[model samples]
Target: MSLVIDIHTHPAFFEAINADEERLHLRQTCLGLYKTGAAPLAHIFNQMKYAGIDRLGLLPLDLTTTHGVELVSNAEIHHLVSLAPEKFIGFASVDPRRKDAVEVLEYAFGELKLSGLKLHPAKQKFYPMDEGLDAVYACCLRHNKPILFHAGISLQPDAPSQYARPEHFEAVALRYPRLRMCLGHFGWPWVVETAALLLKYPNVYADTGLLYFDSAREFYQHVFTRTLGQHWVDRSLRHQVLFGSNNPRFEQIRMVEALHTLGWRASTLELVLGGNALEFLG
Candidate 1:
């Protein structure tokens, strides 16, 4: 089996939230998650074991400027990675709208030793092409870090989907051709546009984190087979697609099983499930 890596996961609910009230508040306000209670570390390990996931790319959302909260702080991610450095790949989050955003990213990369950067244009309320973010983008490029952008729909209240459209990232891609980036959730509902970007830019990629309606298998069939054409990934974008479960919102096991049902070739599955992520992270 190829090394399996889940490239999209929010670990805020797993051993990150301390107080029940805090967890509840985050669930309601920041995360839009109804699932109550914090999951112990063991629960996540068990889930990974059952799902055949070798590592998790833990993502944090720094919504301090827009929502006055850090969905999961950089420090907390560092702590979680510290607990099991071999099992977790920590990504840093910074509010790009802040004047100190570049500085914060510097600390995250230099001091915390995070692997990459995760940003949410919809939740952060910033345009991907905004000049204000030039410094932040430069910082990531300077550190040779890839970025995972929250593309497409957002479950959080007040997070508009318009800001995360796949087209909005073209300019950034054009400017920083060397900086690798993944459009999270496959830019669902605009899957074609996402595919276009992936085709046009070598540095651009997408992840299979979308689960909007119905069973995972059904949804993936609709998106990957009917909507995007059955052989699109296997034929064209195998090297650019990464396996992402968007866990905490959806179960990793379900997404993994659903992806397997897509009828892709073994080589294609190897790329999507792990090989592609390894390249993206580099």
Candidate 2:
């Protein structure tokens, strides 16, 4: 049997909320592209079916303070998982700057039984290696839960691009050598830093989420084939790459097909498609 795990997704019940100019622009851009408002749970399941995905990972964003946009809370994610335990695995979020942040994460893991944690440094207005975040990393390390960090540019107007750079995450990876971490979006426009981390640290990995988007395909094609050279793809990649569809932005099945265009070996294909994520989630 084949198993495909889409490890990065922002499945949400989106609603109009207050936002800065940048946030408003992003909202309009998405609305123009996807031509929809909210991606309710039922619609998400139908997309999963179309993609032939066996399990879906749902990530919640916690940018209440920085973006002033109300987001799907960890509690809501837990409830969604409960609604369809067999189909969904929820990844919780906690803004490290929040008071009692570690405590909130403890409750999320202990009470909610969330499968993983998602961090967006840019939106949260902290560098990934910020000393203040040590406590949260300690929580994840102790709980043996993987963290999916947003490791690229964010559309939020106030977001600092530097905070999301993949290299900063190298410091955290070094500090907690055993903690599993994934840099989502292949750290686009910084693929070199993202690839270097993947090769240097056994615990660090990346996902092909929005890389398959129409605008990003050319960039990824160059990275996989030309920019980094073939060895990067044929050897350095191996099982460190994972399949992820940032659903609603890109269709999952189409993302799978986009990856197939690379013409990787059968074993590499299997690992990238699902095997790697299963091992990471374990």
All models: lDDT? 0.91, 0.77
Give me the candidate number with maximum TM-score: 1
Candidate 1 residue lDDT tens string, 62-101: 9888878777889989999999998899999999987789
**Model 1 alpha-carbon drift over 4 Å, by segment:** none
What's the lDDT for residue 251 in model 2? 61
1-282: candidate 2 lDDT, tens digit per residue: 368788887665333222244554455453233343554567667777777787888888776666554355798788778878998889989988887789989999999999889998877889988899899999998898999988887654566778899989999999999889999888876888899999899999998875533444564566677656656755777778888877656666767766766757777878887888887887
- 259 in model 2: Cα distance from truth in Å? 0.9
What value of lDDT does candidate 1 attain over all alpha carbons?
0.91
Q: In candidate 1, which residue pairs get closer than 3 Å at backbone N, Cα or C atoms, i.e. clash?
A: none
Which ten residues in a row are the worst by lDDT in model 2?
Answer: 13-22
State the lDDT at 273 in candidate 2.
78
Q: List candidate 2 segments past 4 Å from native.
A: 14-35, 68-70, 212-219
